[model samples]
Target: MADEGTSTKPVRPSMGSMRSSSFLQDHQQYRPPNKPENHYGIDTVVEDIQASQISSPRQISPFNGIPSSENPPKIVESGVTHEFSHPNCTPAPGSRTDRLVATLFYRSSAPRISNAIPSPQRVPSPPRAPHSPKISALDADIPPTMAPSSSLETFPLEPPSSEPEPLDHLYGSHISPMCITSFLHLMSTFPLPPNSPSPTSAHRCLKLSAAHENHPEVVELTLSPAPSADYLSLADLRKHELIYRFEQEWNVDVALRADTLWRRYPRLVVFDMDSTLITQEVIDLLAATITDPPDLAARVADITHRAMLGELEFDSAFRERVKLLTGLSGEIFTQLRQVLEVTNGVRPLLRALKKLGVKTAVLSGGFLPLTSWLAGELGIDYAHANEVVIDEATGRLTGEVKGRIVGKERKKELLLEIAEKEGIDLQQVVAVGDGANDLLMMEAAGLGVAWNAKPRVQMEAGARLNGESLLDLLHLFGFTEEEIQQLVA
Candidate 1:
């Protein structure tokens, strides 16, 4: 089959040829060290045929008759042997050559053929993009510096600034009628404004005035003209609004000022005695004094509730309830007085008010006997209420009211009278109550406080206290805890 002048002697093979030949022979007879019982040697005939094919490239495959020299074997670490053709050789599906190649490399532990030839030293992969830690949805809007720390040692601390930073300019301020604890905490983050009005100069602005001993609740300060000049941004405003609007646990209310809170301090404080100063409604307790009549107490209580809710006219309700108590002995007032409960925080509140020279008056729609007694007990300066008529002969209730019914209109008139008598301006008076009857007086005062009042009263009140104590009212007036403690001490 040789052509004339063509050399029949085999061409000298390269080093790769010698190594692949030896490896093939060694692998043909090889058995795994762990399984010496198995033998995987190829038959002599097949070995001879494969060697001839390797020697002569033309005899490798019959389909395309490709030369073996063009397509060499590449050994990869994955235990799969790949045959690389000159351009490329794609074995046809189900072909005899494809099956033969598959059988030759079936899960064999043979050494990689590429190891025989030196490969270019591996070039390391480029460093991956710096990892970005994911943030929680709730904290996505928070600054990275403010994010929660996993460990105390890893927490970042701010380095001291080389230069002193200017104070945050005053934008606007709001005083919550509730507790000052949260408000004080919020203010700790920002420094007090510079060149801001002082207590003495605050009175000059007429919009805001300095906090004084008389009006500890008043905080009057000037704001920068430009909103953007202040450290409190619009977002911070929104946050403050949310905090104020949803604060329910504390009983204080809030008042906002764009410029100042320049107003005279309250010189007089008029209280609705029944429920404002005292926890019990005097009329309800009086009715409860009728022990002999089971249904009488319940009936009087219903009328009292309706009148406070504005469902019934106070005068008519008072008369109806008083009529039910006609047969009761006058001694019942003594029993009722023994069980009267004072509103929480009233003692401290009164003491604070008294020290500030704020006069107090109790305008009650209940009986005068109890109102006057409560006034003396609480050290209140003035007391006014409707009188319950008592028969001198029997020493028992006459089932009638004496003097004018101290209804809603009368209460308002009394408030004006008291202010005038005290020689104080109407604007310098504070009124606190919980019923429809007291609304007129409440409206007449400079500061109207609805103390755990009906919904209607609360809606109209300047400040509403729905919390545990009357002490929060002191906070609204701008009294700090230190000042309060000093006063108490």
Candidate 2:
């Protein structure tokens, strides 16, 4: 059962390497007292924002996978009792700096176990097949994520839309007549790798309200695996092939998921801050302050890229990078705020979620200073990120991080904690990120969208949206162009 020279030693976390009374006091809510099995935990938020001494420690899952009973998470509710005094910096004035911490509390997540790598399909893709018989709203034999087809609710079942969603974000009113073509045969011949027989069927109801007469429109697809198949595994494989076939080949974006009513209505959407919400990686930005060592910023950014690709363990990489920023003034974070640029389509996306009564949060692995600032500007309700130790008198960083670093496992825990408090089911939540660590939480959500992610992440994530604007995510939620206009209005 063991390989030669393989060791089973538990590597201590880099976050634990820093020793200081201040860090210890600021980091207990995340540090659990004991490890237990099958127990659930919660991340409490003490809503007074100041980077004040109020933060709870978060846990990281040691192994890969979505959170389950096996790796039970534990959290301690250390009330808002302390204060972190750092000078404030605002990129755009009038942004709210409320408490946005997802004090995560979950055991390790369980990684997906695959029998084989998803094989590539035939070179020349199959021509678009004829549209299959659309499933009626009243049918019980529908996709895995939908409400049981057997339910007897008196309300009329809203059937899936057969039309394509508009791409208004890119094209204004110049109408292109040839963009909306049916692509249903792609899934009717489902479970793509190895050229296998269809073990499941998928469909979508697209009714976009926006106008992109000249641009490509989005379409939705729901999957239903046969009795003997593994729903999640099957869906993952199907998703991979759909993307492999269209995402790069013709520049057409794909969004696949288990067809469910929840897709039509989501209450909470969580985003990763650094690259997902903003264009700059905050850590690399901080690293730019280092001039003694030439090209330190580039070197750190490379490591950052590698870590996101799942090449290096994020925890260790985080420590190595943070260690390089030792002796830098805390004021640099404030000054760096001026250069932070929000990603394309973030403003409209957040505004749409808000108008539709959906809650949003930013669970960043980067430091708190920028995370809090971005959250304030976008009106995100909750934001959680690692805090850097600052000397109260000198206003400079000590090259030490306070509280636990929010790694893969930690991010998943934060997602679960937020869903539990909001009374939102895991299936109704959406997690979006572009890194290896984000995979854990992404897999945990009802829908995991890899937005212009690395090759590995794009393949492993639940679904992907490589569109020009983050606003395209609305289509995945089954929103029609008409509905999109009303929601963001």
Cα lDDT of all candidates, in order? 0.61, 0.64
lDDT of model 2 at position 60: 42
TM-score result, candidate 1: 0.51
Residue-wise C-alpha lDDT for candidate 2, range 1-489, written one tens digit per residue = 789899888987776656533433446566455744222223222222333343355764453544443443343245543333222222137542211100000000111111221112213223333333332223222332334334447323664322222332132221112212223444344334333323332333344324434232444433333222333354554455553543322335454444446767789899998889987788998888789798889989999999998999998999889888888888887898789988898998899999889999999999998899889988999999999899898887787888889999999999999999999988889999999989999989988888878888778777666645787688776665667767677
Q: How well is each residue in 132-159 modelled by candidate 1, as lDDT tens digits?
A: 2332223222234532444556555752
Clashing pairs in 1: 177-252, 177-253, 178-252, 178-253, 207-262, 216-477, 216-478, 217-477, 217-478, 218-477
- On the 0 to 100 scale, the lDDT of residue 4 in model 2 is 84
Which runs of model 2 end up more than 4 angstroms from their true locations?
1-182, 191-215, 221-233, 239-243
- Model 2, 335: alpha-carbon shift in Å? 1.3
Error of 2 at 333 (Å): 1.7
